[model samples]
Target: MPFAPEKPARLTRRRALAGGAAALGAPLVTVFAPVSTGAEDQLAIRSDILNVEAMQIAFDEDFSTLDVSAWGPGTRWIAHTPWSGDFGGARFANPGERSPFRIVDGNLRIEARRDPEGEWQSGLLASVDPDGNGFSQQYGYFEMRARLPEGPGVWPAFWLIGKDRSTATAEIDIFEFYGDKPDGYSSVVHVWHRDGRHYSRFHRNAVFVEARPDAFHTYGVKVDPDWIRFYFDREFVWKTETQPEHRQPLYILLNLALVDGPTRDATPDPSHMIVDYVRAYRLD
Candidate 1:
């Protein structure tokens, strides 16, 4: 449901070496262009190396084992709130009982709890499969190593979608964290059209963390073909080429929404978002 659309039009920035040189605190350079499509694919922005060697993993989940083969619990992720609903402010239960998902020890929590009639119940997971079969990929590097969950209507996320859900644009927001904006986070990339009209590219940083929003970091994205980087903890903060790209095959989504902004009422009933790992590479 957070696969937003409709509000896009001005976002063609692409020339950012981590937001105006990390807002004046400078000292982290290294650029290298060439990828306007003449294709020799260059883009090398080394703000002190973490380039992720070529790439090769191709899927690795360290949730210790709840690998429903590739994930698809929470009843394959159903929604309810506004239209397919669920853009936050609660409501998404279903995966048995008050399902809010869990995996414990190896991480992969997701909760948001409240119900007993007070109504909140959360948790969503998807990789396809619920009659839609599973797995999808196109350009990779996707990652996640969470541990977020502060309070105020928390809205943790890790996204990607486009295994063809009839087309809600092709999203890719590898991070969303909004527990009242502890330190900041948000990343997006949507490209839709089929008369629905859209084209987005976003990044809403504010990081300088010294840990504590639960701790564990690392959020990433590196879709290629025409670039779409964005990482944190591994540095290299943002990148985009934006267009109608995203050539099919994409599927992975994790949720913990409950937004209505301004603490949405000041969340905090059961809030969680742990994770701990979710990888995917391949591009070597």
Candidate 2:
């Protein structure tokens, strides 16, 4: 489910009317075409692997504005996780003037810093709320292009959570970066039933790739019926068997978190994770 965004210098979002299909649970994509500003949407993901026309854009967020509201009826994003489980060393703060989210130069800056009360605060955005009022898809290509913050105790991630919680909770971690280990990141697939069942059969992959502090990089996952494929900067990196629990509509979440453990150096007072875009695509 997508809402059309204003055309900034970097990307253009054109909306198409979608009513009947939306009523039937199909959310239309706010179609996007790349602008000359940068390599934001220039990646050709599955042209050679699958039919080009088979995939259609489902969701797109260039973060022109932080469209968030309370965990109620009508917001595109909820500030915290739907289950009220706020993770990491830093607290996930509410959206406000002193909030961690800021739209700077057509990008979303998720800042990790201390509030006036001397408590650490950061940002997290989820596409779905507890009432199931936002966007979620069973299978698609989801991605985020971002410039990570580097320093001790800083943690950033882009991940997904299955919407149905009747039996189990499924998670697909696209990438989780620990600033303490700036040379690489990790991808994990997890499933845990309500009664603490089916937790061991999952994939935990550690990807070894050096990070350039000044440049932005892309991290993504293509979730199909049989496979969950990961990509770095449009280059395929890893894959695993898609779990049965993961075959349901899953919501998106991206955040800047602080590590819970101690580190050698001080955490950056005002660290930031600059996100260019978070998007999704579904194959026909």
Candidate 3:
């Protein structure tokens, strides 16, 4: 069956904290006035979303420094057509000196640019390192604060894959944004079997926002034994009971890709996806 992202509910201070805490199996602690008044108060609300009880900080990458120990550069990703065909136009390139991926001002920036030969080159980062050393978890809450790029042909995504890539692969897409659809993004889950079969589900939703795609927003997902939930900007967006039932650990992947879509011809020379942070928490 096909799936689409439902329109998100209007996020209120009370709802954001209370709902998120409940989802994490935690109790809400702070009480706020019906109408919040200052920047300090707003910051407090945001903090609660991250520090919910019954959850332990498993992995946190602020990108304050380019720590290759925690994240592997582009060499960890391979350049090939997605799904075994030459469909997507962009080629994933190995990391070089400021070529496609970089760290600046405490943020990790992944850019899609045209090479000197006029070929599309972009950045892809993975939790698995080139030496086959990396991090993965069975089930947890994963979140990323990022600002996406705008303009045609640009695609930025944060996703996870099972540790075993050879067969029966499991994947979870936290968020995928297309520049052409400036107001929405997609989330999906897939379980690919070794016999060339697959089970897939997806949700594409239009966000209610006044800012452009460049504005920073939080995208998150909670994976459990029987349920998978998604959130945008700390607000609950969607939930599903049909899960991948993945038993092995899963690793993270982030990329800025170019696809053959309506916006391809109009895509700008350089498009970027700026990431403020990526974090994971283990459920108690």
Candidate 4:
């Protein structure tokens, strides 16, 4: 069972007489309000729905320090755009110094640039944790706020990968943006990958009413021991509860990639994913 985060209780002390002085000592104590149960603390998921509990500020400007130790180590750090196949002796940009992935003005900026070969090379931040933190978590909530760039062939996704290389435990995409079609974005979920194959069942076509390139919009997932719900800009857009696979706690991931998948085939120009924040929460 997943445990909730509770507030601390207030402290108190009674007065006592001093040995030498004929006076009572002042009672010194600190009081604290009880922390709320994870389920009790809610985020306005939508005008009609609410997320029972949600993580807050999981990653923000405060996380300016990048500790490679905190990240997974199995994955290789590659620079240059995403789609460009790794070639021999190609000089790559430094991962930590490139402007494509940087923190500025309280937001995370990741840009995708068009390479000389007319292929899109963009930023990608994936995990190396063989055992993601949440691989065992059956259910919880995930959320993110971001602004996507405008252009074609740009894929900005907030997703997760399973620790087991042999099979994908479960994958959830909070938001996926195809830069060319700036009016709408997608939210999807996948399950049970095996033998280099993956199956997906998801919901799509959630139009982002907010001017995507102009402002940041909130995206989230409300996962329970039994159910999973998705939201965009406080609106409950899609949900899934068909087959329950309450297995493990899955770690979190956020990245911006220039993909030429089924969504789009054009090479996007310099595009960006401006992330205001990323967060997650578990139920009490």
Winning candidate number (lDDT) = 2
Q: For each candidate in the order shown, give its overall lDDT on alpha carbons.
A: 0.62, 0.71, 0.65, 0.48
For residues 139-210, could you state the per-residue lDDT of candidate 2 as single tens digits? 988889999888888878899888886666677878777776677777667665544343322233344455
- For candidate 4, the per-residue lDDT at 92 reads 26
lDDT of 2: 0.71
1 or 3, which is superior by lDDT?
Answer: 3
Alpha carbon RMSD to native, model 3 = 12.5
**Candidate 2: residue 76 lDDT (0-100):** 85
By TM-score, how accurate is candidate 3? 0.73
Please provide, for model 4 over 1-284, each residue's C-alpha lDDT reduced to its tens digit, 9 standing for 90 to 100.
00001111211000010111211333222221222223422443342285444433332323343322223344322232122222111122335544466677867677666457744455554433433432223356666788877765555677644344333345666777666666777665555433223344555554755455447777777676555677777677666552343245555556565443433344445666787766655564
- Encode model 3's per-residue lDDT on 150-240: one tens digit a residue: 8777878888777665555577888888777788888877665544444666677678357566888999987777667778887766655
Q: List candidate 1 stretches off by more than 4 Å.
A: 1-43, 46-92, 95-113, 123-127, 130-135, 140-153, 160-173, 176-181, 186-220, 224-228, 231-250, 257-284
Which ten residues in a row are the worst by lDDT in model 1? 8-17
- Per-model TM-score on C-alpha atoms: 0.31, 0.78, 0.73, 0.63
Please say which candidate is ahead in TM-score: 1 or 3: 3
Candidate ordering by TM-score (highest first): 2, 3, 4, 1
Among all candidates shown, the one with the greatest TM-score: 2
